[model samples]
Every structure is written in structure tokens, then in C-alpha cells.
Target: MWVTSSTATALLPTAIALGNFDGIHRGHQEVVRSIVGVDATGSEDCSIRRTVVTFNPHPREFFSGQRRQLLTPQEEKVRLLEALGIEQLVLLPFDRELATLSPQDFVEKILVRQLQAKRIGVGKDFHFGYQRQGTAEDLRAIAQNHDIEVKIVSLQACGRDRVSSSLIRQSLQEGDIPQANRLLGRPYQLAGTVVTGQQLGRTIGFPTANLQLPDNKFLPRYGVYSVRVVLEKTALLGVMNIGCRPTVNAEAKPTVEVHLLDWSGDLYEQTLTVNLEEFLRPEQKFSSLDALKAQIQTDCKRAKDLLNSQL
Candidate 1:
């Protein structure tokens, strides 16, 4: 999708799908699918542009002190939406003024005037306007007056549970990778820059590249996982450990340390994206450094076996 900031004036009039779309999970996918499906059947005169309207700084972060965990970063979210055949992505900056717009003003100014949306798709629970005064019903009424088409997609459910970003976060926190993947339609991945660490891994004969995760990104449970690491655009098999170094009595800040199979290089400051393939084991406090080293050896063997099996 063509990603553009709101300040960019030279954008096409388009049909917009509105939401935070944090995970762009199955529910969001359904909305996008409806837009594309409608666009396909319309005549040339009815040709509508497909776009996504999303906010930065996430409204939750601004309205509340809670540091909401995100399933995807802005860049990655745009990339995934583009892959799904969206024509454009409108990134609206969330500030005090924009946040406080009334329901009518938001519709008239943004949806009708700025975006020129011929049709808008939103979930049933979507709320906007000052203090979330606008509801799906309010949007429909506004759309009717403005000659805009409104589609309210019902909530999507997976098994007995509703598919949502918060639910996905819960799954990750509990180390339920398989269940999280089902909700996300893909494996959970983390992206960050590789940074220097204490070099303790090297001393234990298992050198690792420590990564600095992005702010607001949800981290998986602190444990070792069979993972696929992408460095400099190449994918490698690895075992990743996410937790404090309890065996060494280190401070409790969470860290992601990856040991790439048969790989050696200066990866400091380089970005690496790690995709968790399977939950290997939970983080444990080993009796000694030797015990930790021995466990790592076993972990590496299991990781290698997993990779080979996949191949």
C-alpha cells in the first residue's frame, strides 16, 4: 500500500477502512477483503480507491497511562496491508486537537472532505469523535446524509473466543505460540537492532547477538524458542532466549539473545527480525554457569533438529 502522512496533500480520493488494526488480525482482514471484493464488482464510474486510515501514537497510549503492547509496528502494519492489496495507507497523527473532533466534524472534515471516501468499513464496536461519542449507528446516519456507503463488519471469532489483539497478547504472554499464530494467521515475530551484551554467552561457548526490541511491541514469554532470524535480509535458524540472566544474578530487564546456527559475524547495530517457530522451554534459574551452558547445548541441538526437520 502507498503509505503517506496526513500532511501530504497529493493523495487520491479513496474508500477507507478505519481502525487501529494493531495486529491486522482476521477481523481486520475481513474488512479489507470486503473493500477489495466490492471494488472488483463495481463499474468504471463506480471505481473506488481502497485505503486504510490508522493513527500513530495509538489513541490508547494518549488517553491512558497504560503502555499498550502492540502486535505490529507502523512500518510492518503498512507492509502487511499492502501485501493484502490495499491501495493506500493514510497515517493520521493523533494529537489533542484531532482526538477531540466531534462526530459530525470528523465525518465532514476527514471522511468526507479530506479522504473523499466513497465507502467506509468499520467494525461494529468502533467508536470515534470527542470522548468516543460516535458509534457505528452514528457513523451510518452520517454516511447516509453524506452519500457515503458504510459497511459494519461483525466481530470475527476463532473457536469459542473473539479474535482480537488483546487476546493475541494474552496468548503470547502465556507462551501459547500455536494459539497466537492461529489468531494472527502467522507466527509471532519481533524486530529490533542487535546490540552488544556482557559477552557471557561467548564464554559459555554459545555466542549470541543481543537485540533491542522496539517500544510498544509486545514481547513473548521469557523463554527459549526455536526461531527463524532474519539478519541483513537473510533468514537463519536459531535458538532465542528472552529473559533476564537469572543464572548470573543479573538485573531483571528483559533481553532477547539469539544464537544463530553455524553463524559468526559482527552483528552489532544491525537490525534483526526474529520469528518464533515453536516454544522450546520456559526460562529457568540454573544451579550454576556450567548447568546453564549444558542446558544451552541441549537447546541448540533441539533447535538444529527442528530446523533440519523443517528443511
Candidate 2:
């Protein structure tokens, strides 16, 4: 039900929500949830398709730097939007050709010519077009000319601050896991493929699944954490370390090591999601392997208590 610009020749008469939807945070959800037509109530629409329009390469990253860490990759975005009742996902490439579109051109080319959208839901602060000249007001004015309707949703707030991906990223960078989790409406998670490790954990009676995070994925503060491990069909309780293994004299390159308390499977080369529930402490270099193993045991106990309470 999801297609990029290259594959999209035609689409259904959809009611569309437009934005990057990075992190798919609370504020972004408000825009998607507002597409319930003039009556405004249901999360899903049975009469017509509900679609999401987001840009590939994120406009911010396209204009700025490729080194920017993405909150949710395109694959992850598809899953989250699908759960929120979006039937179609449209990805517009954010290259120079798209960047040159004027406000009027954008309204005609994509919103009308391609989508033929029944309704459009956007944030009050949403902007588009060449040089970022278009505003929500501009969109509404143009929509009236085309006999289309637009809904502008107000921003959602977390405590005194507005909920935003930037704010969430900042919280994670600072290692404020609880604050980040609260804003996300879920735990902050990172996904990576399990790779071979030096077998140091097994030598100490604790075996671990080592993960090398993808290059473009954002990482939180380098430290130890209480986490939830997501396998293919089930979740497990775990403790994780996010850093180079200083005690073992490993390389300076950072890696993730997860020790699932109740899991004994062979996870090599398998992709897994590690959800950071709470920050346990900064990664420390124990003077001895015995000390490191003992501290890990302590961390396991702490993680089990926290996870059991969640259950």
C-alpha cells in the first residue's frame, strides 16, 4: 500500500496528511488523527483511503548534511503509519527538481494532479515550496480555488514544550531516557544486526548479542541501559552496553551488547530492536574482568526489577 514517486503513476481519491512525520511523534499523530472529515471523530476512514505524504532523505537532511542521523528510517515509518490507519504512504524524493517547485506548482502537481485528494491535513506551522515560501494559509487559499478542503491541526505539547523530533533527539543525546520515552509515547529503540563478538562475556558466564548499529541511525548517549529486547515474535528483558569494550581492550569503535536474561538462542546475523527504557549509568572501564562481571550482574538485577514492574 506504500509507494515512492518512481512507482506512483496514479492513486486513489485519498484524504492525505502531509509532513516528514519524523519519529512519528505526538504532534505528528495529531495531524494524522485530524483527517476524520467535517464530523471529526474516528481514527480510521472506511469510505476513502487515508494516505501519508512524507519526503525521502528528509528535506532537512537533503539541504543540510547527509551525516544527519535519522530518527526513523523509511522502513520503520511504513510500519508506524500503517498502525495509525494510513492505507497509502507516498515518498517524494527531495532533490533539486522538487526543491525548485513553486507554491502553486506544488499544489497543482502533487496534491491535485497526482493525488486528487479529498482532504488534506497539515500542521499549522507546515511550510513547503521553493525557498520554503508556502505556509498553511497559502495552502488553504489555493485549496479553496481547487474546491479542496484543508485541516490545520495545532501542535501537541509535552509539559511546557511542544512535542518535536528535535526535542526528542536532544533528550536522547543527553541520555535523559525517561524524558525521551515520555515524549515518544513509547520507549526509544535502536535496531541493528547481531554480529560476532570477542566472546569475553561468555568467558565470564554472561553471553551477549553484539550489534553494530547502521551508520545513519541516531544513537543515544554512550552508556549502559535497562532495555527490552525485541525478537521476531516475542520480547525479552535485557541489559545493554553502548560503547567500546574498554575493559577488554577492544577497538574504539562503539558497539551494542545486549544480554537477554531469559533468551538462549543463536542471534548472530539476526536483526533485533533494543528499546532503551532507562539509563542505568555511564559505561565504565572496570580495572579487572571480575569487577566488570560483578557490575553486570548488578545491572541485570536492576533491569529485571524495572521490566517486571512494567509487566
Candidate 3:
């Protein structure tokens, strides 16, 4: 999907799906699918684009004056949306001026005038305008005045619990990888560039790739995990440690280190995406290097067996 900033010229008349879409979880997927399905029915009108409208800097981050932890950062979100068949993405800069717009003005000016949206899709709980004063019903009422159609999708659930970004974040923070994956309809992933580390792993027979993640990326519980590493077109089973390495340097900062099973290469500066498949264990400080090495060997075996079992 192609992306554009808010200031970009108005797009062709579009059917827009709107939300923060932080995780692009099952619920978000339903919203996007609803709009895409609508667009498909009007296939003859090539001028009507399938668009997704979201905010940059996430409104919560802007208000907090801090970088909020993100479930899926901008690049990942774009990839997920593109996979859902969205043709356009519009990122509106959430500044003070935009925040102050009233409900009527927001719909008339931003959606109708700027985005040229002919139809709008949002979740049932969606809110917009200054101080989040507008509800989904208000959106429908306002958009109707401008001759625009609106679709408000109900909440999606897995078992009894609703599928939402906040719930998914809680599951990750709690190291409930299975629950998180179920809600997301896929394994929760972390993508970043591999950077140089202390070279401590190789000294003990397990070489690892140290991942440097984005500041705003939400980190799961600090623990050992069984993961799948994506390197270009290859997927390798791996054991990942997310911790401060208390066995080596107790004062060290938290870091992500992945030891890919049956893989070896110079991976410095290469980007890699790791999908968390299972939570192995919490970080622990070993009494000695040999003890830590032994435990890692066990961890590697466990990871291999678990990953291979899925096949």
C-alpha cells in the first residue's frame, strides 16, 4: 500500500478504514476486511480507493510527551495493512490544531475535504474530535450530512475475552505468548537490526545475534523464549533471551539475544524479525559461566524440540 501524509493532496474518492490499529489484531483485521469487502463490490469504480487512516506519533504518545510502547510500529503496521489489500494509507499528524477540531469540522474538513472519503469504516468504540467527544454514532450522523456512508464494526472476541491491542499488550507483558498469539491470529513479532554485543555467547559455544529494537517497540516479559527468526526468505528456529544478563554483568541493560539453531554467519547490522512462539523461562542469574552455559544448552534443545513439533 502507498502511504501519504495529511498534507498530501486529496486522494481519489475513497472507502477509508479508520483507527489506531496498533497491533492489527483480529478485531482490527475484521474492520479492514469489512471495508475491503465493500470496495470489492464496487470493483468497476476504479476511482474509489481502499484507504486506511491512522495517526502518526499516536495521540496518546503526543499527549504524554513520551514515546508510547507500540505493539506494531509504523513499518510493521504498513506491511500488515498492505497484506490486507489496502491501496492507500493516510497518516494524519496529531498536532494541537488538529486535536481541537470539532466533530462536524473534523468530518467535513478532514474526512470529506482532505481525504475525499466516500465511505468510512470504524470500530463500535471509535471516538474522534476534540477530547474524543464524538462516538461512532456521532461519526455516522456527521458523515451522513456530507453524503458519506459509515460502517461501525462490533468488537471481536476470542473465547470470552475481547481481542484488542491493550489486551494483547497485557498478554505479552505477562509472558502469555499463546494467548497473545491467539488474539493476534498470529505469533507476536519483534523486528529490528542486529547489532554488536559483548561477544559473550561465542566464548561459551553459543553465538547470538543482538537485536537493537526501536525505542517505542513494546517489549514482552524479560525471559527466555522459543522463537522463529526471519532472515530474508529463510525461517530458522531459535532460542531468545530477553534480559539484562545478570549471570555476566548484573548492571547490564536489558537486551535481546537470539541463538539460531543450526545457523552461523556474520549478522551484524542485518535486520531480522523474530516471532515469539513460546515463553521458555524467566531470566535468572547463574552461579558461574559454566552453569549458565549448561542451562543455555538445555534451553536450545527445548526450543528445537518445541519448534520442530509444530512441523
Quote each prediction's TM-score. Answer: 0.88, 0.91, 0.95
Candidate 1 stretches with Cα past 4 Å from truth are: 7-10, 37-49, 305-311
Q: lDDT by residue for model 2 over 1-311, one digit each (tens)?
A: 66656425546777889998889888888898777443233344476668888887788888886657778877777877888877788888889999999999998888887887778899989999999999999998998788778899998888987888999999998899988888888788888899998878989988999987767778888888999988987888999988888888967778889999977979999988889998888987899999998999999999999989988
Per-residue lDDT, model 3, residue 126, is 95
Clashes of each: 1, 0, 0
Clashing pairs in 3: none
lDDT of each residue in 220-258, candidate 1, tens digit only: 899999998888779899999998878877666888899
Query: How well does candidate 2 score on lDDT at residue 111?
Result: 88
lDDT of 3 by residue, 1-311 (tens): 77888536546788889989999999999889877855534544567888899998799988999878899988888899999988888899999988999988989888888778878899999999999999999999988888787989999999999999999999999999999999999999999999999989999999999999987789999999999999988999999999899999865568999999999888999999999999999999899999999999999999999999998
Error of 2 at 7 (Å): 6.7
Worst 10 residues of 1 by lDDT: 37-46
In model 1, residue pairs whose N, Cα or C atoms come closer than 3 Å (at least 3 residues apart or on different chains), thus clashing, are 1-82
Name the candidate, 1 or 2, with the larger TM-score value: 2
Q: Superposing all C-alpha atoms, what RMSD in Å does each candidate have to the true structure?
A: 2.7, 2.5, 1.6
Question: Can you tell me which runs of candidate 3 are displaced by over 4 Å?
Answer: 40-44
